[model samples]
Target: MDRTELAQVLTRARTALTPQDVGLPAGSRRRVAGLRREEVAQLAGVSVDYVVRLEQGRGPHPSAQVLSALARALRMDDDARAELFHLAGSAPPMPGTVDEHVRPSVQRLLDRLDDLPTMVLSARGDILAWNSLASALLGDWSLIPRRERNIIWQRFLGTPDPRRSTVAMDDDERRATDAQAVATLRATTARYPRDPAVQELVSELRRRSERFDELWRAGGSSTSWPFDRKAIDHPSLGRITLDCDSLHVPSSDQTVIVYSAEPGTPDSDALALLRVLGTQSMTTAG
Candidate 1:
């Protein structure tokens, strides 16, 4: 690794970004012109110490995921993102295919939302990483095989069950969700035309589900993924409705999904209860 050069690049990038650019608040009593190492850490989902090490050129080489997150946090363009990856001793990701790499910064962001249901999805709809509460609320995804970790695959190929969602969806709602899933998959296929696994998935779906095949013929795009509203039905907690929000790290082609209920509402309390249940399950497992 070119430690000196990497450090210089990181320092220069960090110094150039403003809080406004990254959607951070501009607090008072600021000393530096740009964001602090800690602020950058928060934005990038890394530790301040790691940020310091990187800026000082003393840290170990970063992963592609970390470099990509830093690229987004620093608002680097495509050229700069490629440079970041190259300096970190990796090739740039192929165009059209989304990066499936989940950064530590993203995990840190998930860790902070213990009371909410949060999960990460790769460009191909694979469930990458999810917190305990996400498992508790969304059903235990970890129990499923890795090959079956894809959202589109499970929705269409699995047993006909709309209850895969925590809430009861009317026929129209279920149809819409199904259509969206197929459309998203179609768009992904268009983007990663050469990905063997994705191609295999398309073949499998076409062979198995007539609905998926029909939708495949129709088509869909990532740009049209609707705003999500999710509801989970817990035998113990009843139902909790959450407004689902997504943050995409375009460079990595990974998205973090957070499900939150309005504060001061019963739905919020239900989510808190689920957190407790998740904690209990962990303790028991340990």
Candidate 2:
């Protein structure tokens, strides 16, 4: 791709956007569909001439700060940001293509988090390792085939009925998570185009769920963020609202997700009951 040509097109696209598109009110329209070039430059904390130079590919290499400003100004998505990095011949600023497997120390941490529902997940949300609480809250996750252990795969295959009757779930919440999962996968594909597991999961989701297929094609994606106000119905727990926190372990592409409910609340009571049931289930299996 011609960097100069791409940069020009990108700048034009940014210019065509209205101030309202970037959450600014149309103060007084002059002659453009979007904000004036100078307005964008001002908003992005760059010189109007620099913006012009960038658009024309005559600018010097942009610093990360400037790139970030431009990304915001352009309202670029993950794909766009990746493209910007490629055009600039810079390594991705965020984690990418991690040789991400669960380390022994991380594994030990997972084991110790048994009292908490927790899992070690790859950047793409693969279930690399899970603690017993996670298994207890979900199912006999260990019994799941390794290939089927992924969150994306589980969403598609975990239920056969369109209504997901086997699991009590809020339809909207389930769909929201499903959309977020697809977006996460999309971002992963951009970063690790050759990962076989990601490819397989994408293929399976497309085949198994029409909604997932449509959402994936719609270009859904997200930055790593905390999951707030999540609910799940454990066969044993009945139902519980969980506060889920996802933490990025520095220097590794793995994330540790931990879920908990407030003490003395109904959800907490459900968690306790689920733990009892999990112990019983394990005993029976043993």
Candidate 3:
């Protein structure tokens, strides 16, 4: 991640919002597209030097309240707000988790979603278990080595085969995804702070990816409700953006992510093609 560029973007985003846009009066003789640093500082309840420090990427990390104020002052959306946290380098405080021994119940819920593209995920975005449809959608999940089963690991390490078309996610998308991965892991770390798997994953990511190292210090956090979308490519499906939903299984630390396409869209056709290929594979195996 380009810290300097990110800082500039924050400043630019703040400047892009009109005073009237943020419910401030538009005074005479303003010569910029958005709010001034002093205005943002006043609105966010921080000092001009702090805002300047933030824009220069040299400030103390802002508290959540200050961050929220800035986000509002800059008219940031949810995604933008999350990205700001990433830029400022502060993670959210952890929420409590249920005990770890409840995996069986979670697995049972996974079984119930047999036809959906669903899987049980650990706090680190690790694929603890998946339904048959998820395995099918992912195209040969078991073929993945254990160490690469985590979503973040897969994205960073999985190179597309020559015959497979590349799915290029911009740096922002990759960073956002990685931030979620880290925050998910952070939440898990809070509950099972001693798990060797979690420790190993964190250490490996930190050592390999400078971006991960930068975001790791920020303590980004997320929950398992609502959904996010990603345009994914499969050798057979070509390219499809799946609408993915994440939910927490009651009394467990695991999350379930299910993917689907909009009804009657071309993406839906791609999902059908995937199902056909999956059926053929099953028949051949049988």
lDDT of each: 0.72, 0.64, 0.63
Model 3, TM vs. native: 0.55
- Candidate 2, residue 159: how far the Cα is off, in Å: 2.3
The digit string of per-residue lDDT tens for model 2 on 7-99 reads: 775676686676534423355447865567776675466777987777777777876546644654555655666677677766445534533
Q: What lDDT, from 0 to 1, does candidate 1 have?
A: 0.72
Show the colliding residue pairs in model 3.
Answer: 15-34, 90-218, 91-218, 91-219
lDDT tens digits, residue span 208-241, model 3: 8887778889876655422488676665556788
After superposition, candidate 1 runs with Cα above 4 Å error: 1-96, 160-165, 220-222, 279-286
**List of clashing residue pairs for candidate 1:** 45-105
Best-performing candidate as measured by lDDT: 1
- Judged by TM-score relative to the true structure, which candidate is superior, 1 or 2? 1
Q: Candidate 3, which segments miss by more than 4 Å at Cα?
A: 1-105, 161-168, 223-227, 279-286
- Best by the TM-score measure: 1
**Each prediction's TM-score versus the true structure:** 0.62, 0.57, 0.55
Per-residue lDDT for 1-286 in model 1, tens only? 7878888988898888765444344567989978888777765667789999988889988976578667756767677778888888888767655665556577567668756778788877877667667766766554455567777787777654332335557889888888887777777778788776678888999999998888778865654454388766654555678898988777677778888888999888878777666523323223
